[model samples]
Target: MPATIPFKRSEMKRLAEFAKREGVRAEIEVNGFVFRVAPDFNPVRVAVTEESDLDHALAEFDRKHGYS
Candidate 1:
C-alpha cells in the first residue's frame, strides 16, 4: 500500500534553514520514506591535545552540563 503525505514548501524551507544554522542534519518521515537535509560541507576535525583551547572549552561545557 502507498500513502500520500502533504508537505508545505514554507515548512521545508524553514527546516532547511534550521539545519544549516544548527550545523546538523534534519529528517522528516513522509509516507514511510525518510527525507534528510544537512549542511553541505564536511566538518573539520580538530585534534585537541592537553591545554588546547578546544579541550578547555569541552571541559567547561562538560562541567556546566554536569557531565564531568
Candidate 2:
C-alpha cells in the first residue's frame, strides 16, 4: 500500500528549493493531477567501502555491465 501525504501549496517554493539543492525529485498532487519537479542534470555517484570483497564485487559488476 502507498502512503497518503497531505500537501499545501504554500510549501511549493520551499520544496522546490530543497529538491534543487539536494538533486532530488518531488511530486505534488492537486485536484487529482500530479506535478513533478526535478533537479538539474547531475551524475550519480557510487560509494564503496574499503573492503576487498566489496571492491571485487563492484569490479565484477562494472565488467559485467560494460562500465569498466
Candidate 3:
C-alpha cells in the first residue's frame, strides 16, 4: 500500500489565499515529511511537432529493438 495525504477543502482554500497574499512559498510538514506548496508560475505547454519527428522517433525505436 502507498501512503496518502489529504487536505480539507477549507484548508486548501486557506493555503491558496496565504500563498497569494504572501507571494511566497508555503510549506507543510507531516509525519516527518515536508512539502512545498506554490502556485504554478509557468506551467509547461505540450509542444506540437511535425509528423516527421514521430516517424524518426519510431524508426529509432525499431532500429534499437531490431524490429523487422
Best by TM-score: 1
What digit string (tens of lDDT, one per residue) describes model 1 on residues 15-58? Answer: 89999999999988877777689988877766666449878899
Question: Model 3, 38: alpha-carbon shift in Å?
Answer: 1.6
In model 1, the worst 10-residue window by lDDT is: 42-51
Judge candidate 1 at residue 39 and give its lDDT.
82
Global Cα RMSD, each model: 9.5, 10.7, 7.2
Residue pairs in candidate 3 whose N, alpha carbon or C atoms collide under 3 angstroms: none
Which order, best to worst by lDDT? 1, 2, 3
For model 3, the local distance difference test gives 0.75
TM per candidate:
0.49, 0.40, 0.43
Lowest lDDT sum, 10 consecutive residues, model 3, at: 43-52
Worst 10 residues of 2 by lDDT: 42-51
Q: Is candidate 1 or candidate 2 better by TM-score?
A: 1
Q: lDDT score, residue 8, model 1? A: 76
